[model samples]
Target: MLGAVGGGALLYLSFPPRTLWWLVFPAFALLGIVLHGRRARAGFGYGFLFGLGFLLPLLAWTGTFVGSLPWVVLSAFEAMFIGAAGAGIAVVSRMPAAPVWAAAVWIAGEALRGRVPFGGLPWGRVGFGQPDGPLLPLAAIGGEPLLSFAAVLAGLAVGDLVRRLVLRQGPRLLVAPALVAVLAMAAGPLAALVPATPNGGEDRTVTIAAVQGNVPRLGLDFNAQRRAVLDNHVRATEQLAADAAAGRVPRPDLVIWPENSSDIDPLRNPDAAAQIDRAARAVGVPVLVGTVLRNPDGRTTSNSSLVWEGGTGVVERNDKRRVQPFGEYMPWREFFRLFSSYVDRAGYFVPGQGAGAVDMAGVRVGIAICWEVAFDDLVADSVAAGAEVLAVPSNNATFGLSEMTYQQLAMSRIRAVEHDRPVIVATTSGVSATITRDGAVTASTRQFTPDVLVDRTELRHTTTLATRWRSAPEWVLVALGVLAVGAGIVTRRRAVRRAGRDEDG
Candidate 1:
C-alpha cells in the first residue's frame, strides 16, 4: 500500500506545472514492484490505491466549482481502470520479457478508459504528461498510445532490474532485464532523431491573431452577464485593429475568438450580429466567432464557431463536434439533478457533426473547441481533412484560478507535435497562446487579463505518421496485451495440471 501510494504521488508530480517528467519512471517502477508477484485481487487493490493517490490530487480542479462530490466519484471511477490493469499485469508477470507484457497491459487499459462511458474522459493520460519530457518527440511517430507504452515499458524494466538486484540474481539471469531497460530508455532519443517537418519550405505562412477577452468574473455564473462577455471579446478585437492601423502590430489575415465569446447567437440576435460585424470590419478580416445557436425546437443549443466576414456576415462555420458531457450538456439530467442542484445549471448543448475544419480567406483552420482538444481523433480528423493550421477555442473561466488552463495548454503543445502543425489557443480568460509547430510557445497572455496575440504562423499541409495511422497503433498494443494475458493464463493452468499428475503418480 505504501509503495502504491508513493508511486501514484510520483506520477502526479510528473504532470504539468512541473518538469519532473523523469520521475514517472520511478513512480511506475514502484507500482510494478508492488504488483509483481501479487495475487490478482491484491494487485487490483494496490493499483486502486495508486490511482487514488494520483487522481485525487490531479483532478481536484474538477470540484473547484461544483464541490468535492463529483471529483471524488470521477477519481474513484477512473481508478477502476488502473485496478484492472494491475490484475492483468499480475497475470503476465511470470512470462518471458514480463516488463514488455506489463507495459502492453497498461496501454490496453488506457485504450478502454478512453472509450467507455460517454466517449471516455482521457484527461490524465500518461502521454499527456510528457510534453516537457524527452519522450515528447515520440508523439510524432505513433501518437499518445505509443508514447505512453514507451514510458510504461521503461518503468517496468527499471522495476524488474531493481527486483533482480534485491534478490541477488546471477549475471545470466540479469541480461534480459538490463537489455530491456537500456532499449526502452534509448527509444526516446532514437525517436527524437526522426525529422519533424512542421513548417517546411513547401508549407505556406499566414499572419493570424488570437484574442483573449477577460471574462466578467470567474465561476459558472460568469455567463450570467452574457452581453458583458460578448462585448469584452469585441472590445479586444477592436483594440487589435487599432494597434494594426497605428503600425503597432501586423494586420492579421484572420482573428479567432474563444468558445462562448459570444453567448448570444448572432444569427438570432440582430444586436449580437451587428457587434460581431463591426468588430470584423474594424479588424479588416474575418473573425471566427464562437457562439451558442439555439435549435428550432428551442430545447437544445449548438456550440459553434462561425466565420463572420467583414461586410459579408457569416460565411463559413464549423460547429464544435465534441460537446462536453456534464458541463456543456448533462447526460442524465433528471437522475443527476437529484444528487446536486448544480446539475440543472448544465447547458442543453448538443454535439454537432462535421470534419471540424473551416475555410476562412483561403486558410483552412482546424477548430477544436475547449473540451474537444482533449480528444485525439478530433484533432487528427481535422488534419486528415487538409487543415493547414490548428485552432483551439476555449473558455476556461468556469474553472476559476486553477491548474486546468495550464494542463490544457500542455495538451495543445503535445498535439502540435502530434500533427506537426502550428497551434493557436484562444481562451476567454487569459493563457491564450500561439504555439509553433515544434511545440514551442511563441507568445502567451497572463491569466485573467484581456490581451491580443498577433503572430505570423506557418501552415503545414503534410500529414504526420501519427496523423495517418490514427488509433491503429493503440489497437495493436491493446491486442498484444490481451494475447499476452491469455497466454499467461494457459501457461499457468498447464503447470497446475502437470503438478497434479505428478502428485497422483
Candidate 2:
C-alpha cells in the first residue's frame, strides 16, 4: 500500500515544474512490484490509491478557485482508468515477456481513457511527463503511446530483475530480464539515431510574434474585465510594432494572441473589432486573434482563432473542436449543479469542424487551442492536412500561478517533436514559449508577465512518422494487451482444473 502511494507521488514529481524525469522509472518500478502476482481486486485497490496520490496534487490547480469538489472528483474518476490498468497488469505479470505485455496494457488503458466520458481529459498522460526524459525521442517514432510504452517496459523490466535477484535465481534465469532491462533503457538513445531533417530541410522560414497580454487579475473574474484584457493584448502588439520599427526586434511575418485575449465578441461588437484592427495595422501583418464568438442561437459560443489582416479585418478562422467538458460546457448541467454552484460557471461552447488549420500570409498554421493539444488526433490531423507550423493559444489566467501553465508547456514541447514542426505556445498568464521542431524551448516568458516573443521558426511541410501513422500504433498496443490478458486467464484456468483433477484421483 505504501509502495503504491509512494510510486504515484514519484510519478507526479517526474512531470513539469520539476525536472525529475528519471524518477518515473522507479515510480513505475514500485508499481510493478505492488501489482505483480497479486489478485485483480488487490491490484485495483492499490492502483486507486496510487491514482489519488498522483492526480490529486497534479490537478490541484483545477480547484484553485472553484474549490476542492471538482478537482477531487476529476482525480478520482481518472484514477478509475489507472485502476483498470492495474488489474490487467496483475493478470499478465506472471506470463513470459511479462514486461512487454504489462507495458502494452498500460497504454491500452491510456488509449481508452483518452476517448470516453465526454472526449476524455488526458491531462496526466505518462508520455506528457516525459518531455524532459531520454525517452522523449520515442515520441517521434509512435507518438505518446510508444513513449509511454517504453517507459513502462523499462520500469517493469527493472521490477522483474529485482524480483529475480531476491529469489536468488541462477545466472541463466537472470540473463533474460537483465538483457531486456538494458535494451529498454537503450531504446531512447537508439531512437535518437533516427535522423531528423534539420530545419525540416528548409521548406521555408518565417518570423513569428507570440503576444502574452496578461489578465487584469487572477481567478474567474477576468471575464468581467474583458475589455481590459483586450486592451492589454493590443498594447503589447503595438509595442512589438514599435520595437520592430526601432530595429530592436525583427518584424514578424505573422502574430498570435493567447486564447481569450479578446473575450468580447469581436464579431458583434464594432468597438472590439476596431481594437483588433488597430493592432493588426500597427504590426503590418496578420494577427491570429483568439476570441469568443457568439453563435446565432444566442446561447452557444465558438472559441475561435480568427485571422485578422491589416486591411481585410477577419479573413479566415479556425474554431476549437475539442471544447472542454465541464469547463467549456457542462455535461448533465442540472444534475451537476445540485452538487456545486460552480457547475453553472462552465461555458456553453460548441465544437467546430475543420482541419484546425488556417492560412496566414502563405503560411499554414495549425491551431490546437489550449486543451486540444492534450489529444493525439487533433494535433496530428492538423499537420496531416498540411499545417506548416503549430500554435497553441491558451488562457491560463484562471488557474493563477499554478503548475498548470508549465504542464501545458510540456505538452507543447512533446507535440513539437511528435509532428516535426515548431510549436508556438502563447498564453494569457504566461510561460509562453517557442519550441523548435526538436522539442527545445528557444525562447520563453515568465508567468503573469505581459511580454512578446519574436523568433524565426521553420515552416515544415514534412510530417514525422507519428503524424503519418496516427492512432495505429496505439491500437496495435491495445490488441497485444488484450491477447496477453486472454492467454493469462486461460493458463490460470488450466492450472486450476488440473489441480481439481488430481484431487479427484
Candidate number achieving the greatest lDDT relative to the actual structure: 2
Candidate 1 residue pairs in backbone clash: none
Candidate 2 lDDT over 344-441, as tens digits, reads 88999999999999999888899999989999999998987678899999999889889999999999999998988899999998889999988999
Off by over 4 Å in 1: 196-202
The collision pairs in model 2 are none
Tell me the whole-model lDDT of each prediction, alpha carbons only: 0.89, 0.91
* Minimal lDDT window, size 10, model 1: 195-204
- Pick by TM-score: which candidate is best? 2
What's the true lDDT of residue 107 in model 2? 90
